[model samples]
Target: MAGLSSRSAVAIHALAMLANRREGSLTSAEIADSLESNPVMVRRVLGRLRDADLVWSTEGRGGGWSLARPPRNITLYDAYVAVEEGRIFSRHTRPPSGACEVGRNIGDLLDAEFQSAERALEERLDRTTVADLLQRILAADKEPADH
Candidate 1:
């Protein structure tokens, strides 16, 4: 039932912003302001990104966060794996009753299907980079020209 959580989305947004502003670092408060989110939440998401080596942080004066590598090198799949809680699709909370023939076979039968779907999703994610996302954002924000 659970899919990519808000943390994953926030991670992507934060990374995109960081990628766009490659010249300097940004505090979690500043990043959160850009995202219209809580600074604490931004810090938490950025912390996860930091742990994954997607972003790095500096403490104290002029301190903030910055992408560890170029945006083009960071795939969306990396962020997804960094913040998402579990698989794209999840099994039922309770194990199916093995006493029933259908229950006994359902997990095994659906596992391959779920795995295939996850692979498809990950493939799409792997194709999208933070640089690509920032480019799209920049393009969308551009003012239309008058003819």
Candidate 2:
């Protein structure tokens, strides 16, 4: 189904990194290093975030990226919406066969179902802010490992 893209993951990761290091700006290379990804990919994701005003950047030496607002103000859904290009669920590439009874009815039914599912996912994401996620991440990192 070609479900979701990795953009959301990258965006969320970058946001959490920024939240963790709130006092200073991070270069794309630095963020990328933590992600084990390249600077180009990090910059691409950051560009969308910048467009949404979730983060900002500056030019020249010693300048890079920083969050535009406090972590508490930015929700996961905000990052999702900023970077994702379309609905989480996709529809058929072409019209289903109108002559067939199942095909005729399936398109509308599937669309309604997919939209509902997408909305539910969005609502769940909206409940957690960057601050909340950072807290959970920190707590999780402190957990003892089982042998």
Candidate 3:
């Protein structure tokens, strides 16, 4: 099975960062730094997020990215859907030979399984929000005293 793209990861990370700084905004460069990525890459993903209405941006001085809605209102599924479009699992490009019983049935069976899995994934993701993720992230991090 093919895995989801890193664009989803970037969008989630950026969303959490924005949630953590709900009072302000973060430039694309700031987000890219956290991901060890480039500003353009961050911008591209953020642009998709913007289209989804999960985030908004500004221009000129102090220009940056900010959440369009409250963090609690933005589920991980929202971010996932914004960046990752279409199916994560793909069926065969061409239909299998109908002469073989196994080949004839496998495609439909696998597609049903894939659709079920995708639904499960979406359900799980829809349960968490950016605020939820940030809380978990902070709780899981090492404190200065531990360092």
Candidate 4:
């Protein structure tokens, strides 16, 4: 099945890290280190977050990124919309040739399905905040030793 863009996942992970921090911001390098991902890729995702106003960047020696607001104020849907470019699934870019009846009807049918699915997805995401995910992450981190 098709899935959310990896950028959405990275945005969530990066936001969770920020939410977990008690003080100070994390540079792109630090976030990249945590994700074990390329720093450039992390920066790009962070840039998108910044553009969306979900994150704010600081300048200078100790400069880095931080949430624009409290984690609880930011829902997963916010991040998803910011990074997903407003589309859950890719759509037909070019019109189908006037050749087949199925081709004429398929796009509309699939588009309706996609819209319904996207709405449900957004509704669920709206109920989940960055703080909620951070809590889950923290709990998971503590679970191994408890087991």
Give the best candidate by TM-score.
2
Question: Please, what are the lDDT tens digits per residue for candidate 1 over residues 1-147?
Answer: 787678878999999989988597999999999889999999999999999999999999999999999999999999999888778787878999999999999987787899899999899999999999889989878957662
TM-score of model 3 (CA atoms): 0.92
Quick one: ranking by TM-score, best first? 2, 3, 1, 4
Report the backbone clash tally of model 1: 0
Question: For model 3, which pairs clash?
Answer: none
Q: Taking the candidates one at a time, how many backbone clashes does each contain?
A: 0, 0, 0, 0
Scanning candidate 3 in windows of ten residues, the lowest lDDT window is: 138-147
Residues 1-147, candidate 2: write the lDDT tens digits: 667889999999999999999486999999999899989989999999999999999888989899999999999999999999877787788888999999899988998999999999999999999999999999998998772
The runs of at least 3 residues in candidate 1 whose Cα sits more than 4 Å from the true structure, single-residue gaps closed, are 98-101, 143-147
Clashes of 4: 0
Cα displacement (Å) at residue 94, model 2: 2.3
**Estimated TM-score per prediction?**
0.88, 0.95, 0.92, 0.87
Clashing pairs in 4: none
State the displacement of the C-alpha of residue 128, model 3, in Å, after optimal TM-score superposition.
Answer: 0.7
lDDT tens readout by residue for model 3, 6-112: 99999999999999894779999999999999999999999999999999999999889999999999999999999986799998778888999988899989989
